[model samples]
Target: MSQSETPSLYASRVPVFPRRVDGFFRRMKWWIMIVTLGIYYLTPWIRWDRGPDLPNQAVLLDLANRRFYFFWIEIWPHEFYFVAGLLVMAGLGLFLFTSALGRVWCGYTCPQTVWTDLFILTERWIDGDRNARVRLWKAPWSLKKARLRLTKYVVWALIGLATGGAWVFYFADAPTLLVDLVTGQAHPVAYTTMAILTFTTVFMGGIAREQVCIYACPWPRIQAAMMDEDTITIGYRDWRGEPRGKHRKAEGSDNLGDCIDCNACVNVCPMGIDIRDGQQLECITCGLCIDACDDVMAKIGKPRGLIDYFALQDEAAERAGAPPTQIWRHIFRPRTIVYTSLWSLVGVALVVALFVRPELELTVAAVRNPTYVTLSDGTVRNAYEVRLRNKHGDERPFRITLTGDPALRVTLEGTPYEAVSVPAQEMVLQRVYVTAPPGSDPAEGARTEFRFWVTDMTNGERAHQDTHFVGRGED
Candidate 1:
């Protein structure tokens, strides 16, 4: 191909200036934004009294201590299954919502969507509405434009800083960290994390905006697999609004469809796609188009729902002059039911595990380098490492004993007592020795299965770990 005929791989993005529209869905978006942002910013500050030994923060990751605390619930490092269960539940929930409502997550509660909406609101307040913004964009550089741009950028940066600041609080005590941060006494990692998050938040939510949804986010593309003919998604009723024209009183005005081709839906779309063109990948299904179209329909004395939430199945029935399928039937289909069931199952399992777990935990590992040693007295001896974990707020003594064989005796290294005191909310590692007297059944056998029982002296709570006691024949 000639140089002029060559196609460029990169195309500059056309900036989108979504006009403000007010209706049910827009109000819903405002409420959702307030609630989600409120939760994210305020959760780390909530206090929960977890005694003197543990953190009092209601929600904390406690990365340094390898623990996660949420109000009354505490998850230790070894109990990572709880975190995994929560992640699985999140995934299932996304699938469930996508299968039922089609990208509602992206349209409303997603961090990108919420933050972008906030940035847009800030922009609109500073630079005026859609027409004004367009004029400003086309005009050359000036003092007034520069001032407005600088002010908008400063506000966006502050918002980004707050977002990053709130995130770091999740991993540490919010009040203490805030003081340290202000005083420049916080850790370097904390500062580094905050800086990175701030930059990303500003770039993605403010500058990138709808481009992030189109190019960065995978959800818009992946949502197709989750949705089916029964899924209710934002769409235009081309059958009702076809043969669109601006002239309402032309020669064939009676034959013209209800659509006035005013471009109201396109103007209000955050993703900058014409919904009347049919289902496009760029559409976030934010329902702003529905609001815009409904307003126009009301003004023109036409029925509403020119652009609305509907399923493919509903389209066929509506075109055939029949009532559309009920909304409940679309949401309660098989795919969504399975996703909801899995999500609930994981949630229930996590809750059950949290309640049933023992406050005292025990783990035993046999020393393998020299598994079995034959003493001068011809007795079989096995060395093992025992870890005792005390989840309680107070320190407690734990008594260790051998459960399977009466002939086997257990002793703690460097101490003569069978019971050891473990610190509160801590794990203590103790070297243990198991011995079988000469000519005992365990001493002569190749291996004897045994259990190490650790009993809490204070509350009588017991935890046990099963292992094999290697004998002389194993060598």
Candidate 2:
């Protein structure tokens, strides 16, 4: 290949060794990490008193029973559409928030960031701070270095194990499972799940780290299109940081900009990209770089925020010696407003449907195999396979009534209405026989509608189904 045909540059993955810093942003990140991780690991263990027969865990996905319990909401298989509606609402919500603020979820709320930060903390505790860890990594194979690395791995393993153990409690009674787990009597499936989660957490959080965010997660690509110049993002103020230089004993230099050329931002970036170069796809916007630079600026007696969260368009405007423009697009712009309204409408409709759902449901398809039969008593007879359902926990008789005309009569073949009851989550196959007198027919085959109505004696709830009553041709 000719020289011109060669690619401009080779792309490679670089490792980030982010340093810890203290500032308002760092404090906020700590608070967010603690609160979010606390909720995630502890929520399944929180108990709610939902009668003796129901599970006490506040949130559970009882796959064995085909039920989902979330606080006060209990979802059955019949309510699956509600879950779909909620998912749609969540998607629209993500879009609306992304349009308002660029990648806030990626920076702060992402699980990868949360767990990685935690793993890094454990690393710091065992090995010391950023500089010490770098020195240790650079040193030869010494016993001290080996001991520090060993301690860090042990801590990482423990955190991963705890993370995995917390996840399985949502599937069963948390307290009982914990006892069973400690006694080594827990189900094989439970231990297998814990093992898998442990491996993933350690590998992704301790080892892979930001690679998961930059290369593995697809959100960054999708968000690239969602962002515009008007979206507020963590950006370096080029106007403030450019023309950077080192400081000397001299009072000031004309060419010297606000940046002191300390490389603090680069040293502390989790993704190892220089913010001064440009905003790259690998930036997670974790804001640790902001904390690092701000602390450096404070030590040098310079004002903070040489880099910051600002609209890039605004930075450009200020760079051109123009008045600062309000660069943030209003959240109520047409597209965002429409999306918000649609999301709210979907949520409202789902809530209404959940609250107003019938306690009992009846579905019927009249048997088609022998549509009708002639009775020995000279009346037309129709045999139907009917299934009875009772959603209530306590069983009771169902008063079945057939309503059509005065001459129409119905029977349960060999049973009475008082004997027909379906237990909770149970379906009873019933053979029903319907009869019509000769006077109840037209000259030819007549189309008459009959309703099978059932009233629950336990709750007074009623359910009904209407179908055709076929009559034979007679003159």
Candidate 3:
């Protein structure tokens, strides 16, 4: 291909080397990363005394048993609505934060940001800070560069492996699974899951970095809709930063802004975009630029907040020679209020449902192979598969009874009229037969509605399922 005919789609990738900066936001980010990573890696090892019958891991999704155990709460498969409710609350919380804080979750707590920050920290520790890294990138292949690059990649792979390993612990008994994994006796699914997560972590954090935020993640696009003028975002004070110069007292620059054009903010930005260019969708609002600019402002004997959390509305006010709005006013806006209320209501409702739900459950399925059968005495027998679930923590007996038809007689196939004993936190499927005595015949082509009631003998708790009984033509 000719030089003029180069494909427009073939764009080269550029590397970002963010310099280290120290300030309030930097310190906060350090603490948040520490806490979040600690929780992610260590939570599965934390033990809660869930008794001998249940797994002691504080938070576990026991797929084998179809149960979710979280600290003191144990959720059955039938109670999946609780998990769904939590997801809804998470979405609402994101909306609430975005409405008031402007992509704060993406900046501080998102997994992509957190892992990428960790990866960058590793790169800086092995290679050097921004200037050194830039030099290394431009330098030709050498033994020193090769050694440093190898060491950095090894450390990154280790971090990714640890991240993937930690995630698998949440699905099983952590200590046993760890032993199995180390001894090469774990399930293939476990190994496969770890491999996939490790690849994603390394690829996304080490290789992709800001590309995931810019071209991959949907939150950046959706956040624009969530943000309004009152949203607090990391913004440059352009009203005071315009007419930029290297020195405030340059020739014919008496009216220059306080900005010295040090490029510190740009050098420290992970997204490789200037905040002075105004708000861009690529920016994660990580606030590193704020720290860099604040440090510069401090060194130059100027007041801080040259690049700070400032609302766009306040930008207009500041340009009009008025003070910016208060932080509390910016926080308590209408959208945030609505989102908070919705999140809180869902949480409360889930809590209530969890506490009020029955400890026993019943489901009945009538056999349709032949629909109905006639016995020697001309009685109609309807066979059904009844499932009884014991949600209590101990094995218990439940009395099975039928209602909606006084003439219907119920009998368990194996143990005829005996109470069914269900193991703790388990379900039992039993074959049952409901027979209508000969003289109790109903009209032809009629279906009789009945209820299968299961009452826990230990606690007197009860649950019922309504089903229909098929019958032959009327006598």
- Please report, in order, the local distance difference test score of every candidate based on alpha carbons: 0.93, 0.79, 0.89
Colliding residue pairs in candidate 1: none
Compared with the true structure, what per-residue lDDT tens digits does model 1 show for residues 215-316? 888988899999999999988888898889778878988888899999999999999999988899998899999999999999999999999999999999
Lowest lDDT block of 10, candidate 1: 1-10
Q: If the candidates were sorted by their lDDT against the true structure, best first, what order would they fall in? A: 1, 3, 2
- TM-scores for all candidates: the values are 0.96, 0.89, 0.94
Which regions of candidate 2 are displaced past 4 Å?
1-13, 248-252, 321-329, 383-393, 424-432, 442-446, 473-475
Q: Once superposed on the true structure, which residue ranges of model 1 sit more than 4 Å away at CA?
A: 1-4
Q: Once all C-alphas are superposed, what RMSD does model 3 give against the true structure?
A: 2.3
- The model with the greatest TM-score is 1
For residues 269-360, what per-residue lDDT tens digits would candidate 3 score against the true structure? 98899998999998888899989998888887889898999899999999999999999999997888899999999999998998888778
User: For each candidate, C-alpha RMSD in Å?
Assistant: 1.7, 3.2, 2.3
